[model samples]
Every structure is written in structure tokens, then in C-alpha cells.
Target: MHPELYLSYSSAFAIGLLGSTHCLGMCGGISASLSMALPVGRGFRFRQTLLLLAFNFGRIGSYSLIAAGVALLSTQAAGQWAWAGLLLMTLAGVLLIFMGLSMGQWWQGIRYIERAGAPVWRTLSPLTKRFLPVNNAGQALALGSLWGWLPCGLVYSTLGWAALQPTVPSAALTMFFFGLGTLPSMLATGYAAQWIRSIKSHQGVRKISGILLILFGLWTLPIQALLNL
Candidate 1:
């Protein structure tokens, strides 16, 4: 996999920036709930920040793991581009479209894919309970990791790109970077997500993101051409 091409910063940044909206909707309640778990005190802000970081660390870790796994699996297709690459790219593109729709909350059925990982989510979900008090960073991190399994289109996109990787390391690295790409906005959303989501609501950002994903799908063909058929 060409990291330079497969996990370009532009795409990651776009996903990250647009993904802020999702952060507001998906993680807003969870983060707020974690905040409530904090002990009451003026210094609670510090505790909240730590909790936020832990949550993001867990989420990013999960994204990286999934990305790597998908990429590793795709390695089986190396040198078989005529069939495998075509199929991978096609599925990726289709997934991207569905994800885009799902992100906008315009389509719900696509989330059925989340069921594929449900058993794993079930295993991790229990860890969140241990953080009932969430009085410290460790528990926050655990809860975050547990929450990382939450269904998400952006995460799916990262995994989709990973599945396009020619090797496991490349796939993982690509997604790590992609996860890194999403950090700023998501972090900010954790803080000011309600306002951000409200502002974004009236805009056409979702529609534009969907179109951009369509363009990304089209971009795959030219990329394959550059890969020398």
C-alpha cells in the first residue's frame, strides 16, 4: 500500500473535520455522562479533560487495530489486482456511499454491518460499567476503550481504507494516521459539540461530504491506473 496515496492527509482531514458533527451526536451524551461521573469540585474540569483524552485514546486504539486487521486481510489480494483490487475498491466505494448516507442520518440500514462486530462490542461493553464512578484517568480510559466499539461510519471508512492496503503494517499505519487526523475536531467537539452540531445542522455539510465520498470513489480508478494496471 502506498501510504502517501492510500491514506492521504486531505481525505483524513476532511473526514476529521466533517466528523465533528458525528462526535457531537454520537459521543456527546457519553462524554457528558462521563463528566457527570466526576467528583463535584472546581477542579473537575481537569478530571473531565483527562477522561476525554482517555476516551479518545481508546477510540483511536480501536481504529488502529481494526485498520491493521483489515489491511492484513487484504494482503491476500496482493498481485491479484485484476480481480481482488477491483472487488475491494468497488466494495469500498459502495460502503463509502452508504457510510456517507448514514453519517447524514439519511440511511439507517447500512449500520447492520455493525452487527458483524457486535460480539466484540458486547465483550468490551462491560468494561464501561466498571467506570461507574469514573473518578480517575484509568477508569476513564477503560470506559473510552469500551465505548470505542460503538458503531460509527467514520471508523468504518478508516477500516475500508485499511482493507485496501496491500499489507498489514501499511493498513494499520494508514488508519493510525487517519485516526490522528480526526483528533482535533473530535476533541473540540467533545467540548463544544452541541453548538457545533447546531450550527452545522442548517448547513449542507452532510450533503457535501456525501458528494466528496462519491468523488473519492471515482478517484480510486485513477489511483489504480497509477498503480500500473
Candidate 2:
């Protein structure tokens, strides 16, 4: 891959790893509930693991799908407007900064961006109920696919970054890797809810993650390139 594309993917995965505290707040409940819903029996751990994996597969699949859709639209717009691509990159950088601030509990302005997605979530939320009380991996998968649409500033921030990719597939892959970064936390949540919760609530970890993300956002901006020119 080109160095820039590699950097984009790496940064996206880092964002997912660093911002997973937000993920815990958003999707961890459902993940834990999936475990609790399953009956304790022989092979209980296996079943729980299967269901969680399925759920996350579906969730990550949805993220890639959304990224593709957004990249499709953005690429078309960029084709017509010379400045559209740059605008998207700038927006992505700003969103990342906002996300970092929110992650650190320094500011919550990203909540407003999340609220912008509420209407979409409202339309999709009811569908999740149909898959509740998940009995099988398929049901869990369906539920998770739906849950992925939940209004979230972290997801939106990453989506903005994904949109700036040159191609739809690249954008989708960006999100796919990002989802992978969150897997450790999501998987651990079902097995060790308290431990995961404590990590989410740890102020020191959050602050360090926030500062790294802020630096990343600044690096993502084109200011340095403009200055060099």
C-alpha cells in the first residue's frame, strides 16, 4: 500500500483502540447482555464466545458497509467539486479533535454531532427488538448489525475520516481495521465486565488516549503541507 494509505489505516485502527472507552459506553451493555441471556450449561463459554464473535462480525460488517456508502457519495461529490475532498479531510480532522476532547471529558461537543444521527437511529432502533433475547449466533449477529447503527460520536468521527479515502473499498477497509481495534475490549467485556468498566472509567488512560488522538488529528490536517508549499 502507499505510505499515506497505510498511515490512514494504522491511524484508524489506533483511533478505534483508543476510543473504545466510548465503545464500552455505547455497545458494551448489549455485549454483556448477550452473555447473560445465554443459559449456563456445558459448553457455556464456547456458546458465549461464538455469540459475541458473531455479533461483532455483524457490527463490523455494518461499519464497512456504511463506510462504503459514505465514500461512494463523497467520491462523487469530490469529482464535481475540486475542494470537496479537502473539505472532507478538514472535517475529519476537526471531528477527531472533538472526539479526543470528549474522550478526555474535557468537552462534549461531539454529543451534538451524535445527536445529528439520532433521526437515523430512531428509524433503525425498533428493528433491534426483533432480534432480542438472542438464542443463536444468527440472532445475535442480526441484533449487532442493527446496534451498529446506534448514534455514536466515535463512529461518526471515524466515518468522517473514512470518507476521505480515495476509493470505496479503501474506506470500507479503513472501518474494518478500526472495528478490529475495538475487538479486544468488546470481547473482554462479556467475560470481565468489571475490569472493562474500570478501564473505561480510568481517567489517566482516557487523558493519555485523548492527547494522542489530539496529536493525530493535528497530524491529519493539511496545514503542514500548506506551510511547506
Worst 10 residues of 1 by lDDT: 1-10
lDDT of 1: 0.67
- State the lDDT of candidate 1 residue by residue for 134-176, as single tens digits: 7777877777767777777667765776677666776666666
Candidate 1 Cα errors over 4 Å, as ranges = 1-9, 39-42, 79-82, 221-229
Q: Candidates' lDDT values, in order?
A: 0.67, 0.91
Per-residue lDDT tens digits of candidate 2, residues 115-156?
998998999999988998899999989988888888888888
Q: Candidate 2 regions off by >4 Å? A: 225-229
What's the CA RMSD for each of the models? 3.4, 1.4
Q: By TM-score, who's the top model here?
A: 2
Stretch of 10 with least lDDT, candidate 2: 220-229
Spell out the clash pairs found in candidate 1. none
